[model samples]
Target: MPNVKPAMRVIYIPILLLFAAFLVIPLGILFIRSFETSEGFNFSNYIAVLSNQELLTSIGNSIKISSLTAVITTVLAFTLAYAVNCTKIYTPLKMAIKTGILLPMLLPTITYGFAIIYSFGNQGFITKLVGRNLVEIYGFNGLLIGYVIYTLPAAFLLINNSFKYIDKKFIIVSKLMGDGTLRSFKNTIVRPLVGTLGGAFVLSFIISFTDFGIPASVGGTYSVVATQLYQVMLGSIPNFNHGAAIAVVMLIPAVFGVLLLNYLEKRNFHYDKFGETELTPHRGRDVGFGIVSGVVLLAMLSVFAVMFVAPFVSSYPYDMTFTFKHLLDTFQSSDLTAVYKNSLFVALLTAVFGTCIAFSAAVLNVRTAVKGKSSLDTIAMMTNTVPGMVLGLSYLLFFNGSSLKGTFAIIVLYSIVHFFTTPYLMAKNALSKMNPTWETTGELLGDSWLKTVYRVLLPNSRSTVIEMFSYYFINAMVTISGIIFLVTAQTSLVSSKIKELQHFGKFNEIFMLSLLIFVTNLAVKLLCEAFQKKSNKQ
Candidate 1:
């Protein structure tokens, strides 16, 4: 309340109201519905969900798979990140490795499931090359692989960013003090990164646990909470109460993830000074890491290569003739074309408006002395812990009888709110790095807070703004969980269509549609990168 500018107060109103209408109220309705029973308000739904052996098993399966996936993904991601940062590799090789690691993010999570099947299924290319089925890809093994592919990029990004803040001088000092290599690495690198590793683990686990698309495609008969929630909510006979109960249960782990991440981050060690020591490569270590990282990158690229090739074949494993029939069919199908267009429209809208809202909120929170800005920040962060399935179902229940139930507008709004946190943080980071005296200088020269943002802040953060826009656009293009329930016939998206195509055993069309999405997102990403490079040069 003290020293809070009136302009800062005005900025909080719209942001808070937006979250209240789209996020808070809908989730509140979901919580209320979970408690409803046939007789009265009670725990019947919870009892039924917990007592059902199959449902409980799905919960257990999710935890088991997610935990295992987290461990494997964290190790691989950390290795890749360590090689990139800590070892000496050719610059092109390093860039290629980073690109390979991130390529998975451009496609939908379900696409990884498809890639796994296309690569390891009975008649898969790899299986054919090896002359046998190396592994079963229809159950736990497939789900784990899919989760690893889908979650590795995000985990690597987090862990890699953590490495940048550690001072290299600690390692040099440890060496000077007669410490061995292993002990030096433990004290300097591993000890400082424990918090980041835990955060990455929790994040990867939540993403794998709540993702419905991957499990739906590759988890044959192996149930998970996400797929179970989909079944209860949209199955032959829809049961809102049961669905709400499942959603409520899903929220437990997500909340725990947020709490656990916060706790770990708070306990992270703070170094007194950031050492300027540069990392020098040891010949043996560098060569060893280069070989290992090269193999990992190639393996990751092979999956996408299989996905790219699958759409061109006449029939996978049955016929080896190359044909564009599947791609033609994907575009020729009227419904599929409309869904693709819908995805484009939704992603475009989400990028433009989501960036504006996120930037404005960032300005209020980071650039001005806003009293209630923390409330807005808290609510925005809470959306991260709320699974997309839960948020989508909550919207379904809360807006059931409303006019916005089956509209594209609802999807756009839901996507914006669902993905608000990352873009907000991007904008905040960009703004925080600028000259803090910009606002004071503007005011002394007669510019208002809003004027300062437009003239001084926005222009300087143009690269970050473009990045935020691209982030929102790409995520909106590939996302299925949050908007799965919200998309209607008129607003069907390509990501949802991929799921439908999977259920009908249309593998060719599935790969074709997924390829379309991948190419589209990749093109956008490259364009953004080019723009950023040009801006930096200028």
Candidate 2:
């Protein structure tokens, strides 16, 4: 039995049970739909999906782009993580770089797509100046580039944490024994990171594969499974059956990837002969690395600045006029105000709901020996690695016939499933940091598990809980691909509106919505930091 006071259970249990139901029942519906037709329990949909050339092409393209993105993001993240954590650099510069790298994570995918178009599209000033199609901000190239920007934050955070676990003495010993920088890097850095890098790569690849917003905005003729799912399911006439079929097809790969990641994580553990400790600074590498890191940081900033400025201009490149008319028109001329309101509503709800569920699950898995907690952990892991498109489509299959479809609750459910993994990890990591004896001590004193959680776990893990909430809110505000099918005309989000504006060649309006989403996310992030500081003091 779950030990606790009845009243406390009344408050928390219903919330978690609702989340659990949402997560499981939707995917169950997808599986059932996939196996059924009017003819009953047939594999024809799977066969049709497999035999379709267009579907195959989309699968191939998604794999290619996701692979390339995984490589570029991992390499860049490794370099940046090493530069900051290992080198003796200026504290301000390091903090600035870390913050800047994270800035892209806060903005919507449409924002990145818009920024790329303004800088590289037909009327692009930079493109025209160079007198070349320097880069096509559409099709394969554009989606690939945008995904790299979109998934960098999670990749950086994971790889940096992995680096922090490595012992510094090993590197120092190797360096003192006449090892060159290259050899030392191979022995010390690459060896430790090999498993972690693979995990990051697979995780990012899954994210890019399932993402829809960037591809929808800049994809042009290039189609991915996510965009295809959106078109078939939600366009002109809804083809629920075809969408369900594709959803099933997409889920196969995601489930396989998640399984593979689990297997890899298990095999990744090699008993660390050397214990964890703080790394000693390497002063010589600092100057060279600082400059290189600065250049990378500058490139990232330039993209953001373009995004920031493009909306303010009346028309980008061609007219060079300035106006808040675009912003004003969002409320006056467009249905943007509703979309803005809906996006914020979903974000706030997702943040609160997701954080509660993730924290409870983490507590169950880490702080208590609850039955089936391992399964809960595994389910959370599986969903985290599952592509957003798969989950969204699954929900469509599961809920379209139910009262949940075409509702705000659906969007909240999608956000929770789509972004569950990171927050779970965040919460578990927070719980892990607390001394195990705290709970044991409480048990000896006859305090219930619920009481211990109330007095100790929640208070100590406040910063991490807030971090998870902020992450959920920021990603939900920007996410498009995962919840695309779930969103109705009534629930159109700012991100979807940005995509709509882009399709109609409403560049200025697109920029305006993108800017609004970005600014709102930034404001929320600042608020999270303020709360974190206050919590630390208390």
Candidate 3:
């Protein structure tokens, strides 16, 4: 491999060191800890995990629930995506459907679990309206509902993007051959979407499997790997060895997810040519799908509506009157206020620093002649497959008794590494589309690589940078599992506060805090969008 420019090498060293210190070291520590026992280094922890019936049961439950969630979410998401992208629905209706499906991505995952409880629990408002308990808000059923909503946006996004490159001419050709509706659909749509569907299923499965928030809220009497890991790590005894063991076990499915994703990506078919002809919609088919899609969207929206309204009421199912007491009580608490501020501080830092590091890393890997950059890419991508509970516990074990313990800086660092893969991919995608000769152009002008990047590349990728910043900020705000084990009294976050409140059955306050997070994240998102728009116009 050719050597990279001196200036580019300078940029790579710090990022390499950052990942080494924060990501590589902690994970290394975790691997060692998983093998340790009271008798010294051995496989006792693994044996304990395997022999424990409840632990094994949790693993089984997680797989079962995640598999079901993936299938259901994939089917629903594909239908909705197909409707919005392919059908001849009214423009307003299409936009509404898209917005409705994407809305779940904006709020915290914990919110969905609470929303289900408040709307479908025994005393739920919707349940009462139907004069019966429509669905259980605990155990497998509750998790199924919550996970579907939690993972739907991801599946929909991937499946929808696959739709864009598909040529409509294939469908027209199938029709021209006198193929019936089902045959045409199978040939044109399903055939091209096979890889995407597999990718979506794997992605959704990993997300649902590793998620702790939803299970913690509504997984009554049901055991899953995420919640079990939390219990072992943070419960009364606080067993790090067993926790590490559970973390190792939890990683298996995620690894499989990553492998499947890679395989699917390799097999994915790309079409450079798209059809010029528009899709002709059938009246009956369009109207039927339109109504069904509308109902599904409305159902998903109602959960959020319940989340918003439940916080204002004095008491759910008991007090019909709306009051501001929950909001006041939440804000007036000194601890809560500090936690909220700490969240804001951490999110802002993560956004700024994470974006800079991710952008630099993306540039080095994509554009520069940086040798061995693939290692860095591998590490970053691997982080995506690691569960937050696993990563957080690893940090706890790695940094315990160190000076960095209990500091906001550690939380910020963990968050940056935890969410690094997405922004890095975004930046890499944006940069890959630029003219390949930009580096040569800079050389011809006697400009260094760094200078060219500073003046030419960065300015052109402004929208993507803003997007990366927002992604980091919003995710940091809503994430709880990643930072749960690392937070101290001095560095508590709003998401963890919501979890704490949930433990004590403080439903109103939980909803209020969740609403606060939603509003704050929404404000940041809108601000980023406005900035991007202004930059584009300028």
Candidate 4:
């Protein structure tokens, strides 16, 4: 028996209130507003959006670029994942490849556009080195490259985790049975990964289609839906009705991605065991895969290398002399300095409060047998399917005149709800593996349920707790879409400030602020890793 039966009930009240106030109600209002027009609620807003040829073209462009990005990113991710797991490569090179692949995640996606510009634009770093522009770093070409780099890390992670469990011994068996190389490879490898591959495509497509950061920076003359939605909502003539309609349309892919992914997940082949076997090492395979994977990793990392160069130069390409004037300029401006402080403030609070809410919901669902507890899981995770910009607009619609409108509380609240699903699932997974009889055993020892939870449950999952905190902190520091509309003049964040700097053609300042964000997130990530390792050893 749970030591105290009512303890579950006590925890349920606050979780329900928080979700009701933040997630459910705001989205509900946005849904209604999508139908609202000057003549009252109807379908005019949506109909007008669909009727516009420019808007329709932008939607088509989003599908085209996102589809291309998904395909290219998934293929590259597979190559990297295969190299890590299958090929015999230099160990130090493998470590570098893995780490470099995910370096983009440390900074905001909004910075991706600027990085691309400084890397390949006519007067760019690499262009100067090579003495020719490789590709135009704007419009469709830039969007393609930026979106690929942005989504590749996630695709690679999902595929890599799945690859670890695949039985490689089948490859040897297929070869010995006289199966051709293609047929043998298909049977041994791709068959088991069809579900994951499909899932990666959907995930990449959804992420690229819904992103605002990459599109905003590099999408010049290429009018994607994200930019169009921004024009309608925050443009010179703001229209809430139409913007909500576009946001509702943006939600279509997310919903489709979720449903498609769920279906694909069911098709995965679950193995009883992943038995290890010795590989037939081919020198050609090793060299081919090693060079290819190295090049891909280098290409992705090369994009951000300008962050180190652009900020320190007197004026990149023109003045080769090193200078700290750009750094000093940023620090001297009080307004700019406050943006960095605001990001730290929002991220820290979001980590603390978001962890509490997610952990509470997890404990409610996994530990207690409360009826309708699964509903909390559903609500907590629903944010995963909704785009961040859509969430920001929904909060704007619902909380337009409320006291929380211009406050940091609104940003923290949105961050918690936006990022609630993953952390909640992490906590739930961590708790599920603990002894189910822990509470019962504690009761025999005369410990109350709450007391047992604090003493036993909390200490056992401290590593997971640390991991959850780091996830919230890094994402909070880097996320832009959901929090973009919520930040005020007084509450500007470094992520949003990059946009402001972009408008003024201040490339150096943009790189400096990006570096600041990268350093901050890297610090949190390192601390969390060190702490988690210590906890594991203990």
TM-score of each: 0.97, 0.91, 0.97, 0.97
Candidate 2 residue-wise lDDT, 434-467, digit = tens: 8887877887898877788889899999999999
Better of 1 and 4 by TM-score: 4
Residue 458 shift from truth in candidate 4, angstroms: 1.9
lDDT of 4 by residue, 1-538 (tens): 3633888888888788888888889999999999998798899999999999999999999999999999999899998998888888888888887888878989999999999998999988788888999998789999999999999998998899888988888888898999998998788889889899998899899989988999889999998998899899989999999999999999998888888888888878877877998677879988998999999998898889889998998988799799999999999999889999999999999999999888888888888877788898689658788888999999999999999997999999999899888888889999999999998898899988888889999899899999899989989999998777888899889999998888899888889999999989888989999999999998
In model 4, residue pairs whose N, Cα or C atoms come closer than 3 Å (at least 3 residues apart or on different chains), thus clashing, are none
Error of 1 at 308 (Å): 1.2
lDDT of 1 by residue, 310-412 (tens): 7787777787799988888888999888998999999999999999999989888787777677776787778888999999999999998999998988999
Q: Candidate 3, residues 92-163: lDDT per residue as tens digits?
A: 988898766877777778878888988898888788778999877789998999999999888888899888
lDDT of each: 0.88, 0.79, 0.87, 0.90
- TM-score between model 2 and native: 0.91
Supply candidate 2's per-residue lDDT for 446.
89
Please state the error at residue 284 of candidate 3 in Å: 1.5
The best candidate in terms of TM-score:
4
Model 4 residue 350 distance off true place after TM-score fit, in angstroms: 0.8
Error of 1 at 322 (Å): 2.6
- Which residue window of length 10 is worst by lDDT in model 3? 1-10
